[model samples]
Target: MDNIDKMVGIRIKTRRKELNLTQKDVYAATGISNGNLSEIERGNVLPSSKALVSLSKLLQTSIDWILTGEASIIDNNSPEISNIEYGLKLNESEELIIFMLRSLPLEEQLDVKNYLRAKVAKYEKSELSSTSNHGKNVMDGNSEIA
Candidate 1:
């Protein structure tokens, strides 16, 4: 199975067990067929974004959490959706954050995340006037740090 499939399956299993839910219960709430969900939970299939959203809500989680086993965490596949079982769109900043995250080692990812959080907090709190500058410094045609 593909890595994305594994991710999906792992997330599904994690959530299902966390809530003491059965595959049938998920089917009842998410409208995903039992066979499909079973395959997905076994890493035999990848779920679409719609399916991911359904599972997320049923599991009381976010799409990112369902897809990558991490909530509010960025990774290489965050923007791709190449193996997502559903179709959905990500905002530009979200996309950029994911892309940027891809360049860091897994161990360093949390550090980068902390930096990003600090940046946002600094700007939001007006603790750093420079943080209010335009995105020209960090934005490219496709990726912007703003």
Candidate 2:
């Protein structure tokens, strides 16, 4: 692959990680295949302009940043260009978690996965209970819809 292609791939991979997204997530949102996304991220294939546009929107960055690693001169003073730097940075906690997970043994990884799934289920159940109570309250005129 060309050097420019590698740079673009790095940008894509970096933004995807910063957003805590998997290739599957990016594929689902952008209609890019997971295999293609992997290839693009590895710099084994150059991304199409359309793929770059979709990725730019979904990853909340600019095509300019993805390709050239800078805001175009014309957009330097724009408020909208200010957040692009953040897109290249993964959260420290997220980076730690990924590092830890990768270091775990396979069985321990499965244990961690199970623990996270249970926690997520608990959170979802609580959210559903709260939503149901809120709906009931509104229907009974005991609470105003806000």
Candidate 3:
């Protein structure tokens, strides 16, 4: 890999470690594949835009940091999507799911989203049901309820 690639790779690996993420974790969330991720982290291969976008979101950093190492963090509360970075470890299923979701149209994606939301809602409901099964109440308290 070239110097820029090497530098980017180092930054990705460093941030991932800082977050205590394993390669499996990242793979699960980003769907870049463990082997491809390893190469990118090693600076042996340049990452694609899709990969970069997914990585940024998962790493909670920024695309700028991964590519040019300019910015450090992404504004999570911003109205628009920031170039956040994410590269902690991920599992294979999670990675593929993330990858598949990223590739979907907004409308179609809603189905998968609802499915996931139901899963979370079910989990939350089950957990709190013992006390008070207020499903909406539980989701309301989550900052990331969406």
Clashes of each: 5, 0, 24
Tens-digit lDDT string for candidate 3 (6-118): 99899989988876778887876677888998999899998899999888876777788899989977644342332223435555666666667756643455578789999
Model 1: CA > 4 A from native:
72-146
The CA-based lDDT of model 2 is what?
0.76
- How do the residues 1-146 of candidate 2 rate in per-residue lDDT, one tens digit apiece? 88988888998898788767788778766789999998899888988989987888667667888888895322322333334545555566666675676566434656797899999999999999999999999889898756
Candidate 3 residue 138 Cα shift, in angstroms, is: 40
Ranking by lDDT: 2, 3, 1
Off by over 4 Å in 2: 72-146
Candidate 1 vs candidate 2: the TM-score winner is 2
Q: Give the per-residue lDDT of model 1 (tens digit) for 1-146.
A: 89888888987888688667777777766689889988998998888879986776567567787776668422335565522534667778877776777565433655786788999997777744555444444464444544
Worst 10 residues of 2 by lDDT: 73-82
Error of 3 at 49 (Å): 0.3
TM-score of each: 0.47, 0.49, 0.55
- Clashing residue pairs in candidate 2 are none
Tally clashing residue pairs in candidate 1: 5
Model 3 backbone overlap count: 24
lDDT of each: 0.71, 0.76, 0.75
